[model samples]
Target: MADPTRAARPPGPARSALHRLRGVARRATDHPRVAALTCRLAPRSVRTRTTLAACASVAVVLLVASAAVVLLVRANLERSAEADAREQAEVVARLATEGRLNALLPLDHGTDFVQVVDAGGRVVAASQNLAGRPAPTRDGDSAHDLLRGGDHQSVTTITAATPTGPVTVHVGASMRTADAAEDVTTAALAVLGGVLVPTVGALTWRATGRALRPVEAIRAEVAAIGDRDLHRRVPDPRSDDEIARLAGTMNAMLARLEAAGTRQRRFIADASHELRSPLAVLRTQLEVALAHPDPRVRSDLVAGALEDTERLQALAADLLLLARLDSAGRTRPQEPVDLAELVRHTATARGVQPHPVTVHAPAAATVAGNPLWLGRLLTNLLDNAQRHARTAVTVRLDTEPASGAAVLEVTNDGVPIEPDDREKIFERFARLDDARSRDDGGAGLGLPIARDIATLHGGTLTVVDTPGATTFRLRLPATPTPPAGG
Candidate 1:
């Protein structure tokens, strides 16, 4: 059978309550308004935040450490007090056992209260501090030998089995002195904490500021750079760190932007000059026709004006196409185009020129691209070849077996381009000295536009060096055509 006392205790509450409370506290800290408020109150810089978080963490750790120290010191002091009281009580017990309780009267100190009591719970003798007082412990529960009253005093009792009966000796040590020492220690710790936290915070702030000085300097330098002066770069610390890497990356980006800006300025200047030439010719022809009334001169003036107008219109269209290509979005839909067929058609459509063109194309060389752009690319390549060729221009279209890429080559049997000038030929407004005249080169944007179109289709148009001929080669990703039945 179970004891009545054992059956009376209630079951404990579930342990998950503590976990739920912790979860709630975590969610509360994550609240948006609280986060916003914290951000507002704290410094915005990363250095400041890191420093403050470190200081706060240090302060918490210090506080916990000080509390632990205080607890340990208090525990030790209490143990020492109890030990002293126990020793005094043991001494008193010995004297009482020897029947020499009266001998302790002159040796007594006022701080420690000692008493000798009989089994009857009556005080037989007492020290100077407890003179005339009854026994502190009675029979039963209080008669048990123990230590108690540790706040202002520490009392210990020990029973001595004397010749007559059991005698209890009680000794109480004053806790006033130990408590005073604890107070002094606690006060000192509090002062140290107050001084240490602020000192650490200030030092952290200064150190962090010093570390971030280079970043601020870089920011100021970059900010001072205007659109016209993208050539300026941020100063690098040269250390292999995140900050140094950031500076390097920024300088690289600035370099690209400067190059692009220079290209844009040159493009605009070239376009303006090209436009002015045609407009001036058209205006001069119109003025000449008004001054002369002859039909032959009038007809000549009309033809000249028409030629200038056509050139102007072509230039405007090319500029518009370039602008559209430069935009971030694509307006044309991508589809599988027969590059071989496209090249053959563009070559056949062009009028008879100084050169005879020959087309060598496979039946089905397909590539993925906008059909219109691909046709324009072929047209530009053919036109360039036709103008430069002395007697013949050969157009070849086929798929490369290794890479499975569609290759289109326009080879002109003309004066070969210099090795050094091959890359420069694809730049907008780039013209060779021999073809600088308006009649020979049509605005010099055809090659650049063709290259841009090729790039849009994930392809490349490059001038390949030949033994005694000029060859413009185009490469596009090849796509397999579906079977007729499928």
Candidate 2:
């Protein structure tokens, strides 16, 4: 027995054909070569497309309007011609009633075909245009009537009462006249379109090109700017328009870029100088040890080399930390950190023996931050204070209930930083020391890194001036305490 569970197979031919067609369509749409060819065949420039579209739109509108006018004029002309013919026929019928039909027969114009039929259905009188034609209508059958004899022959007929009896009148103007009028209208419209469309297209092309000229100039200027020459700016027309605004905005951006480039170059030069000194000293010490044969001098040289190596390592670590801080989307786990305890710990680490450092925190001030980075920030602050202090360093932690922030202030009895130099202290590789020596100032990145860390933790580090003291103040958003009952 055949297996009843077997599923029936679908038909192959129609499905296969559809699948092949779909595959072809996908290839045509998705393939790069196909897309490139399509682009090549299409209008590539905005000017070309705009001109063509404008011309086509005008052409379509003119065509539809001209068609409507031609139809209305043709209808009116046909109506007028037919009405005139009928009126002439009525005149002929009246003449026939007066018994002067023979005089009016064989009319002069020959444009209208007129015939008069008697009550007995006999062709009694006719115009020259219908010389041998039979009666176009039956006896007494003419009342706004159209009579067609051949494919192209037609007449408008009407019946009127004479003195003897009623007679039929046949009248028709040729179709050629109406056709000729429409033909002339169409020919004239064609000629107008031929002239007008090209003119519209040419004007559109020129207008679009003129409008985009400013943008083209901006693009060229931007393209010509090199890494070494970010100071160059695009030309501004100074008009109160979009293009002018765009140029102004671009120039502002270039100015900012140039400033940033200047800072970067300065930082690199400073870093190179800092690194070169240690490296040169280390190399020279090694070379001196090689030249000398004394054991004590070799030992001193090794020690000096180790010190230089440690300084290099410290500088490298600081650079890496800065790099990480600058990277996007880098975050660390946050927890409540006691600012008072951190300040005391950093002050102790920096040695309170020599400088007589003191701390005052009446209440616990807590902030949400990474403990490691917070510790680094405290260490940097304490180090800076100890380095600049003349007598003692004082660490103070307090909470501002109004702003809900924890404030840590490290004050030293050092010379007050100048008003202009205070802001410059936070810039990378900036040193207020006139010598610009790394040995005395420690790579000049400590304050910048400390400020960056404080900012990352939603805080700020700034130098606050007291009467005779230089104080570095750090402010961090305070973590709120929970309800007592809860």
Best by lDDT: 1
Task: State the lDDT of candidate 1 residue by residue for 283-374, as single tens digits.
Answer: 99999998998989999999989999999999999999999888825543458887778877887887567677899999988788789988
Q: Predicted candidate 2: what Cα RMSD to the true structure?
A: 8.0
Q: Residue 325 lDDT in model 1?
A: 83
- As for candidate 2, its clashing pairs are none
Question: What do the candidate models score in CA lDDT, each in turn?
Answer: 0.82, 0.81
lDDT of 2 by residue, 275-361 (tens): 999999999999998899999999999999999999999989988888888772446336988777877776767676557789998
The top-ranked prediction according to TM-score is 1
Model 1 spans > 4 angstroms off: 1-54, 76-133, 137-181, 235-240, 329-334, 338-341, 348-367, 395-407, 477-486
lDDT of 1: 0.82
Worst 10 residues of 1 by lDDT: 142-151
RMSD of each: 8.4, 8.0
